[model samples]
Target: MKKKFPIIETDRLILREVLKEDSADMFLYLSDKEVMKHMGLEPFQTQKETLDEIGWYQTIFKEATGIRWGITHKENGRVIGSCGFFNTHPEHSRAEIGYELSKEYWGKGIASEALEAIIHYGFQHFQLERVEALVEPANSASLKLLEKNGFKQEGLLRHYEFTCGKFDDLYIYSILKGDVVTT
Candidate 1:
């Protein structure tokens, strides 16, 4: 049997499954050049692109490969961003975490909240021994968020990936299950 999509709730946010209906809202930020700058993809030019992204989210979940959640605001019920684990390796009990928030919602502690919820969920439900995040060195915001969440900087993978027409270096960050402090 397939597992149902999990819904994670934070104090002010709802991290739920990404639905096709979220395309428009997703497009709002995803189409922003600044938002997509470190995402390794060009800003989405059409709703069709957003839909494809949603489809990929569904596919990963269905295949037991990974999962993504639309980060919805509890107050306004708007999907202001997304956060998730991908490149999941059950055998190794590890996965890569990725997230993006609408620029409008940046610096408001939203990403931090959503990230905490998912890190907890990933460690518990996914049985993940390690949750990792790959971030461009220039992405200071993400680096700070990861560190605040207890993820340690592993090392830089130089020219690790080619995206958006150039090679980019990525700093890998990880939080081990043993590193988590249960409150």
Candidate 2:
């Protein structure tokens, strides 16, 4: 069964489904090369491009392939980034998690807060037995974030994905249902 999109609120953030109105804010980061460094996506050339990307996200949800939420700052009411699970295999009870934040929101624990909520949702609502993350080798900040959340470093995949005009190595990290401890 497809899990419904639910609004998740943390102390400092709100995680909700992406909307057409979010395209402008999404373009703020999606168009910035520095913010999309590791993601295989090119900077959006225009707001329409961002809207098109949102359409793709809508398809992902409708197809039950994945779900992504716009991470909005509650205090300022600004969308800062996106986080979600994709590559879901219902038969295997597994999914891959991904997230990207605006440059200005980095190092503020916002990602951690949003991810914690989503991970809990994956396990409780979606019945996900395992959640995975694929991160670039050089992204220490992201690596630390996953590790701090109980995701263990699984292995390194050499030349795993082609991005930025070359093949890039990625590190796989995962946390199983048994491994998570609820607070």
Candidate 3:
């Protein structure tokens, strides 16, 4: 049987499946130079690109390979960002987590809330023993966020990823199932 897409809710945000309707909101930030800077992709040029991205999200979920949720506000119902696990390995009980928020919502504790909800879900629902994240060294905000959420930096994977026509080093951070108090 296929697993249904999970929808997680926090006090202020909803982490639900990324739908086709979210493309415009997604495009708003996906096309931002700053938001896509460390994301390994150039800013999206068109809504078509955003549609392709939404399609990728659906594909991964359908294949049971990963899950990406559109981060929506409880009050406004706008998809302000997205967060989820990709590169999932069930045999290894691990997955990589990634997220991005609109610039307008930065530093409002939104990302932190979304991360907390997803991390909890990942551990409980996905049975993930280890949830990892690859973050660029220059992304101080992400580094701090990971640390605050109980993810410990393992080490720098030198020249780990080739993106945007160049090699980039990324810090590998992970939070074990026991690392945080997940309920």
Q: All models: lDDT?
A: 0.93, 0.90, 0.94
Residue lDDT tens for model 2, 21-130: 88888999999998787787787789899888788778888898888889999988778999998999999999999999999989989899988989998999889999
- Please, what are the lDDT tens digits per residue for candidate 1 over residues 48-155? 999999999999999989999999999888888999999998999999999999999999999999999999998888889999999999999999999999999999
TM-scores, one per candidate: 0.97, 0.94, 0.97
lDDT, candidate 3, 81-141, per-residue tens: 9999999999999999999999999999999999999999989988899999999999999
Candidate 2's C-alpha runs over 4 A off are 1-4
Worst 10 residues of 1 by lDDT: 174-183
lDDT comparing candidate 1 with the true structure: 0.93
Task: In model 2, state the lDDT of residue 14.
Answer: 91
The TM-score obtained by model 1 is: 0.97
Model 3: CA > 4 A from native:
none
Provide the lDDT at 117 for model 2. 89
lDDT of 1 at 24: 90
